[model samples]
Target: MRNLVRYCLILSVFIMFSCGENTDKKSGENTVEEVQTETEIQKSEKNVILFFGNSLTAGMGLETSEAFPALIQNRLDSLNYNYEVINAGLSGETTASGKNRINWVLNQDVDVFVLELGANDGLRGIPLEETRKNLQDIINSVKEKNPDTKIVLAGMQIPPNMGEAYTTEFKNIFPELAEKNNIALIPFLLEGVAGDPKLNQQDGIHPTAEGYEIVADNVWSVLGDVVEKE
Candidate 1:
């Protein structure tokens, strides 16, 4: 009789232990689900970082994730920056076109605006003075919408085919604007990626994925610095 009682006690203890373990497992799973939901909600609340430009900003020959803006987003994620990125790049957008489109883009709240337009203008022989004025107007418009919004202008250069006068003037527009507006300026958007056949696609204009990574590094140099100041 004592032996039977001992076995019953042991069986009861084992069942109790098993039930306790199952309850703990359920509690752990609920906690994990709650944490995941909270994380998703927090990510959705991040501020907007709009990348405005042409085909390069759009990642023409590469996957959307491979684009420099997306790469910047990834870097921000890794660095724990609470900003959401929006790539407002079109395949052939010029400075004039950008001015026309800026109003629509500004409809959304933007915390940081990175302008990369004007390469197409230079390539198409558009007037440098006109390009500069259009860019200034765009900056003014953004300021009108969000007075405290930070601006980062990406400088671009066309081939010497456009002549040294136009090319030099085009290159000078960015720094001049940066100083006048007191905004951040990326000296050259194509720093390490330009003129390298290995970095560019067959068109010799759009960058490959590898090239975009370098481009991101270039933007990050000035962008990271200015953002800290902002």
Candidate 2:
């Protein structure tokens, strides 16, 4: 009887330990699953800020991370802003071409839309009215997709090589669109960096990585207001 009792006690202890180990393994798996779910929820909660433009927006000669949009993303993260920056800028993209592709970019929801085309149009001496119309249509498309999406027009300028008359009119296009659409405007996207040989690449058009930093600042000046409201 004593030997039988001892064997029973040992078996009881072994069973308890086995059950405890199984419980701990199940608890650990649950914890891992919970963590993954929480991470996915956080990513889904972030609003998107889409930067739509041309070579300047694309960081032509620099790494994608060196672009102004990526810099803006860093700033947003530092400030604890819940926004995802989407760099939709394409090199050599003109306003007309941008209009065609704007719908595709709008496939996902966008809380903020920063329009940065027209520079290529100006350089190519494309008609100012055509440029203005294409931009307006692009803006309209965004609105139709999501009327609440905030629009920020990035104003651009070209040299007098296009003629003083054309240059003056080209500069006017941005403000006019902004006022007409009641959207925010970045007076000059290249404000401090434009025409500064040191800021530009060998092409004297696209900005270098350092120049994109200043560009990011210029963008945030106007973009900050829109982001804060969100």
Q: For this target, which candidate reaches the highest TM-score against the unseen true structure?
A: 2
Instruction: State the lDDT at 171 in candidate 1.
Output: 88
Q: What's model 2's TM-score?
A: 0.87
Q: Per-prediction count of colliding residue pairs? A: 0, 0
The lDDT values for all models are 0.92, 0.95
Write out the backbone clash pairs for model 2: none
lDDT of 2 at 223: 99
lDDT tens string, model 2, 32-77? 9999999999998899999999988888989999999999999999
Lowest summed lDDT across 10 adjacent residues in model 1 is found at 221-230
Please provide, for model 1 over 81-138, each residue's C-alpha lDDT reduced to its tens digit, 9 standing for 90 to 100. Answer: 8788999999999889999999999999898999999999999999888999999999
Q: Model 1, clash count?
A: 0
Error (Å) of candidate 2 at residue 18 is 10
The true-versus-predicted C-alpha distance at residue 206 of model 1, in Å, is 1.0
Candidate 2 C-alpha RMSD relative to the actual structure: 3.2
* Model 1 ranges off by over 4 Å: 1-41
